[model samples]
Target: MLLGLHDHWQELCHCHVSLSIYLGFLGAQGKFAYKLLNDLFANYSNALRPVEDTDRALNVTLRITLSQIIDMDERNQILTAYLWIRQVWVDAYLGWKKDAYDGIDSIRIPSSYVWRPDIVLYNNADEQFTGSMETNVVIRHDGQVMWDSPAITKSSCKVDVSYFPFDGQECRLTFGSWTYNGNQIDILNGLDTGDLTDFVENVEWEVLGMPAKRNVIIYGCCSEPYPDITYTLLLKRRASFYIFNLLLPCVMISFLAPLGFYLPADSGEKVSLGVTVLLALTVFQLLVAESMPPSENVPLIGKYYIATMTMITASTALTIFIMNVHHCGPGAKPVPKWAKKFILQYMARLFFVYEVGETCKSSKRQPKVRVVDGRTEEGGHQPRVCATGLCLCRHGSLLRDVEYVANCFRDQKAAQKRTGEWKKVAKVMDRIFMWIFFVMVFFMSVLILGKAI
Candidate 1:
């Protein structure tokens, strides 16, 4: 009984201490700071209710951004700040803050979070003579989210009597938050899907600093897996993904087709090999395009692949054309005369002109001849016989009689039998086709090599 009485006595002392502090400062006129501490800090003397135990520690990890409001000297500013009180916390407490109305007008922001002053221009001159801030943060999904700690406290809610000292306008800040089940706010609270969207509620804010500090609170949490909270931030990190599956692989395979050009066309294997590679490329392209989103902008590499394949296809076609032109005579085939003319002039120039010059050297011979005087009354010159069929004979010579003439004619007929102009024309055409085909081939080879490089 004595032990129990001693406990009661301690409780009475705590109550008296709390009541006296409140009453003594009831008419307190200047902006004052008051802190709401968890009963756990009161030595548990009157900790009539124990905090509920929970499995998850981090329920809703909130990244709070706070700023200081300077310029209010009003003392009756009934201000309050709050945080979603964590259950069974080791040390949880609430605090009221100060507003910087002193007009020091200088800010020294260090690497640490400390009290400072504001005013001036930089990012929009709105903070006029100051800097705005942006930061990235990670937090756990704890269903128990904090109220705009810049408000008055009522269990699950927060209300700030007055905030934003610089502005005379009055407004209310309301938060949208999750409702709780047994140990945490179940996702079933908001959306019908039972996904975390159920807890998508706004956590509002009111800013002030010093004297009547833009009253604020730093939500308490320093753990992981936050068992009780339903919306798992860990799960969300893996959820955000893209569906360009077909696009990715197609890009890579199409680029591989250009490797076909490394083969030389002269190698008898070139034609069949090129055709096979083209077919394989076509199949792979079909595979890559299957999963792509039907859209306007194809992947960057897709266009490149298309260009390269088209060139290779064209390369294959030209190879076939060159081989046919080389094997078949242009006159015998359906080749146009102008095409033959152009090719012969430009592409076949060296062969046609050079071979013709060689033929002229072998067939035509300029021989030495003597002009002789004949026994006619007037002086006359007679042409002499030469090796190249250019010569003259006396009109009345006894040896040039009918029998002699027949014998000479027979010899000349045998010589004429050895030559034919039609044969020469065919040989010239062959040489012309050969040279033009080679030049075109060289040009096309350069074009293809350029594409590969």
Candidate 2:
């Protein structure tokens, strides 16, 4: 009985060892089995041929995830994005039962070994691809093919800069199979919506949203509709940089334009100051133009700049007019009565301008004179007319000379008064204009900045 039991135990151990060796052999065979894959390919004449008949549609699904926005050129109307493009489709010929080869579930194969859709971007701007196209293809036991590739694609995008630096843009990447029509290739969206959860933020732009759409187009020449996938990227510009560097300076310069009025007309620098500020504004405008694409509708900043320039030009012209008024000499016409009443009396008082009493008092002061024997004595010693009647008769000339001298003095006094009045009128005008310019600048600033804010 003991011999029999020991023999039974030995047989059990032998059976366990044999089972282990057999399992090891099966595992090794499962790993080294390329023969089955080779057999499958050998049976097919062209691996590149799609499983569907040439006339029947081969449904292909697409999934895209944007990784980054490499660059967007407004001037060139180009958009460059780094994307992971995934193409999923089932190849009926490549399918094999999992039980056929020790439950092999999936395989990684070269993309050249299988059929792939000839997808191309309809609006491609670059002549050559920005990334490598050679990649591995994943195949499941059920013949589901997943071809994922990372690409840096550059495509044409129509740019509208009407509201540049504060504007939002919509750009599209349209993809379609180049050689297959909708009848031959049916493109489907892989996800319910284009996923943007993995999108990397850009420094100059912020992604508002991304939406995907499928379109079918029937060309006039072709009877079949072509399948297309369009991904629209909505982005807004990050305006902080432009606002600080370009807009702030322009606004400051515009404010300074009005300060030119503070320069006294005698300084001869008002025109030069205005023109310098005008040129600086022009340079800022050029900077804006260089940064943005040309468009028929003006940008908000451009409009502001133009308005500022208009104000500056008007101020310069007014400066020139004021200088002319201030420089009027004795030869010029006297200030008009209405102008004196309105500007010198009413407007000057309204603007808080004080009348110059010293000039008026000096002009009104009369020269001291002593009359001797009914004749005026000049310089306290020289006699203007002789006391003798014979002298007067010899020169009724005496009366005529005195009268002529008196008229000369009266004309000189009148000219002095006219010159003073003209100067007062110029001062009044300058005050009025300064107030006008101040109000204009204030209103313009509010309007422009309100729009920007």
Candidate 3:
């Protein structure tokens, strides 16, 4: 039984050795295949393009995937985008069938070992910016070259801030072959639209959509029509930030004009409030100006701010005029009958303003009569009875005293009349301006916000 067990163990060991040899051969074959691919690429010259027919244009297709919008500089009119650019073209010299090469379907070689189209952005702003050239290129067995690399592209754009903050911008990136014209290279879009599957959201801007188009243009200088692919990226400003930070504050400051009217003329703060609000509006205007690029046409927000400032300034001047009218002294000309009737009677009632002098008149006290030694007298304790049964003071003192009281009454009436006239004028002015300001604000709001919408 021991001899029979030893023979079975030797047979198992021989089977294990045969399996190891088979695995070794597979590994060797993989190494040989890799070596063959390397040898083939070693003799490949990237400088030599495989263009058999110079007249037949090399069909190059472009695909771009927007990874992120690094920044959009409105002041400089530059758009910086992070993109994954893929370019595909056919190279007849690199063709090899899978049947001729042990079923090798595709191989990756250094990008320098193949011919590549010199695709360039016609509107590129940064001359130093270039796509990554160290990435590997994939060559299929059917001679199709697929090259993809990350590019930090900076392109110039024409910015129209006419409706800024709520504006939509269409910026384009045009790609075409630099050296080879339409005869030698024909560029086409690989996708109907740019890929945004991996797009990174921006804080101040949002991507609306991207559309790609191909166009052929015949330049006056060049007879061959140059083919180019254009990718248009539609971006809309994220206005919520600007609205909260800039616009809301401006609107609030504009409303301060009404507060100036609420301030009493006696407090001497009406003009000051109006001036302060005007300055605040000016500061906001500067802030908005700093955010937008300088252009011949004013942006919608800027125009609104300017109109607001003008209104506020006019309101301030009107406040000053109203204060002057309220403080118009007694030395000035007496209030005209027509002016008093219109401002004091009609406008006062219309504005719900009460007359100060009328209240005082209704509550005025009568002159007290006092019993003297001889008789009753008005306005004086000492008295003498005359023949007419009226009290007369000694040495015509009653006459002088009567004249003095009459003079005092006259002066009080004049002062009260002046105060009433000034108050009436102020009230009328305030009411008129309140309506004016309301209309101004309403129209301005509609004009500004309507354009944004």
How much does each candidate deviate from the true structure in C-alpha RMSD?
A: 22.5, 12.6, 11.5
> For candidate 3, which ten residues in a row score worst on lDDT?
355-364
Candidate 2 wrong stretches, greater than 4 Å: 1-33, 45-48, 52-55, 129-132, 356-413
- Candidate scoring better on TM-score of 2 and 3: 3
lDDT per residue as tens, model 3, 1-453 = 999999999899667754553444356255545654655666667775577786688899999899999999888899999989899999877877676557777767557668999998888998686755567788887889999988898999889998877888889999888888888888888999999999999998899888999999999998988999999999999898888887878887887787688677889888888888888888888887886788886888888888888898888888888888888887767778888898777776676666545452253355887645423467765564466644354447776776678668778878877876777688677877877797788778777767666
Task: Compute the lDDT for candidate 1.
Answer: 0.32
What's the TM for model 3? Answer: 0.84
Residues 83-180, candidate 2: write the lDDT tens digits: 88999998878878777777777767667678888887889998775543767788888889999998889999989887766888999989899888
| Clash-forming residue pairs, model 2 | none
The C-alpha lDDT values of all candidates are 0.32, 0.79, 0.80
Per-residue error for 230 in candidate 3, Å, reads: 0.8
Judged by whole-model lDDT over C-alpha atoms, candidate 3 comes out at 0.80
lDDT of candidate 1 at residue 158, scale 0 to 100 = 19
Candidate 1: misplaced stretches above 4 Å? Answer: 1-267, 279-296, 329-337, 348-453
* Ranking according to TM-score, highest score first: 3, 2, 1
Q: Which stretches of candidate 3 lie over 4 Å from their true place?
A: 1-29, 356-397
User: If both were scored by TM-score, which would come out higher, candidate 1 or candidate 3?
Assistant: 3
